[model samples]
Target: METAVASAASTGRAQTSRSRCRMSPKRYEAKLRLAEAFVRLVEAMPAERITVNMIAEASGKHRKTFYYHFADKEQLVVWLFRYDLASGLADKFPEDLLVREQDSPDNPLAEFPFYARRIEESGRIYNAPFFAALSYSLEKRRAYYRRIFSTRGPGTLDFYLHQLFFPAIKEDILFLIDREIGRQSAVERKALRERMTSNAGVDFLAEFYTGAFLSRFVERLNYTSARRTARDIIPFENVVHDSLAALIRQEIEKAAREPGSEDRPGKGGAPCASPA
Candidate 1:
């Protein structure tokens, strides 16, 4: 009986450990070191020219360890971009102001001050020379973004940007669409038909707008002079935000008026808009 009890306890412990998704502290630290090494390596050479072996060597970890943490180099790039951009913004900027309801009378694009302030603070976090001149890593960041955006295949800049920003705006977009759908009368619903699919396809509008904003923002960063202060470019951020908001609002309104657009549902249905 004692042996059986001990066996059962061991099995239970193994199962619990397998069920946990979190990484061990040591593993997390290893991954972080690998990521930092990747940034440094990319600065010296283009990301395409670098390999898994180079990263592992620079990080002082086994080459197999890179695969243990990430599926491929592209996945590492995704992690690097998020760490470089969103992680820095998380502390200083208010989460509530990041995204707004599509139907909200308040202009969604009016939060440039928040974005600008976050950029101003980002240099201190990443130790990148944002104000004086772009650091080596910052230069690499621009080059990588441009390369990914210009590529014809998968893993485009827009796809990655959508992934980066999707979480913050998801709830707000859902709420806006659900509220709008609920407001329609049964007759209106029939007039709208299945096109009212998934909050009237607001997500397509949001994702497209986010992608355009990210692509343009990256392109601007690539060409922007290093001497330009974050404050000096505040107006440009405002203009980009406003332009994205206006386009999104216009597309949403256009979808609402079109019957053909109504049949296509977003989020696991046939897309009403192009992913590109």
Candidate 2:
């Protein structure tokens, strides 16, 4: 009788273990479906418009299941940004022009091809929900700058702010170029080059080039309520890029000229003690 009782207990334990193992895959699959559904919903509508019911329906899961996997839609959105968007952009350094070799001379112009390629690739991936998720993440973080630097001291604040801002500006410029100019062939490239140089000054030329690229990119997105026109987006993107680049360059030059002028001190004429 004791043997039979032990056998039954073992059987029950084995069954419970198997059941837990089976549930793990199902749970994982459900979470993946929910994330995918969230992406689709955000693409169709803005982040604010997405509801729990909508996500549940889209994922083909019960409302309770969403709660089991995620606390709320906000948590899910945060997860998507932290995991999905970050994963996509992390290793994809635009190699063609953006990041030059350490030995290479400083050449901002070298980055143009990288920007063009990025825009082209962005257009190709425009249909993917990942791009929309990334865009949403960027939009959400726009206020992060103000929040992070608002209380910083002036000396540290200006330097920190530039470090924070320039990368975003550069990325935006690359997005514009990749979307618009990368796809153009030899002839089309020449025509676009001619058009850019026609009446625009040197400063305006960069803006025009970046603007044209971005406008084409936005047009390709076919966003339902896109605020800027194709013609306008490139120039606006360029202006932002140019302004940020100029500001950063100016700051770096000022630091080079007056290493210890500020509260900080360093050799190699670095503004701060450590190298950037």
Point to the candidate with the largest TM-score.
Answer: 1
User: Which regions of candidate 1 fall more than 4 Å away from where they truly are?
Assistant: 1-28, 94-140, 143-152, 156-158, 163-203, 225-233, 236-276
- Which candidate leads the pack in lDDT? 1
lDDT of 1 by residue, 1-276 (tens): 122122222321111011112223354587679887987786677667889999999999999999997767766765555444433333343553222112213322121111211222212112112212212223446655555455433454345445434433333334343444444554444433344344535566556655664554555655755633344555453443344334434444555555644454442332234322
Task: Provide TM-scores for the models.
Answer: 0.50, 0.31
The pairs that clash in candidate 1 are 195-262, 195-263
lDDT, candidate 1, at 248: 39
lDDT scores of the candidates, listed in order: 0.45, 0.38
Please state every model's RMSD to the true fold in angstroms: 13.9, 20.3
TM-score of 1: 0.50
Which stretch of 10 consecutive residues in model 2 shows the poorest summed lDDT?
A: 12-21
Q: Itemize residue pairs with steric clashes in candidate 2.
A: 115-178, 118-178, 119-178, 119-179, 120-178, 120-179, 211-234, 211-235, 215-230
* Model 2 misplacement above 4 A: 1-28, 39-54, 90-245, 252-276
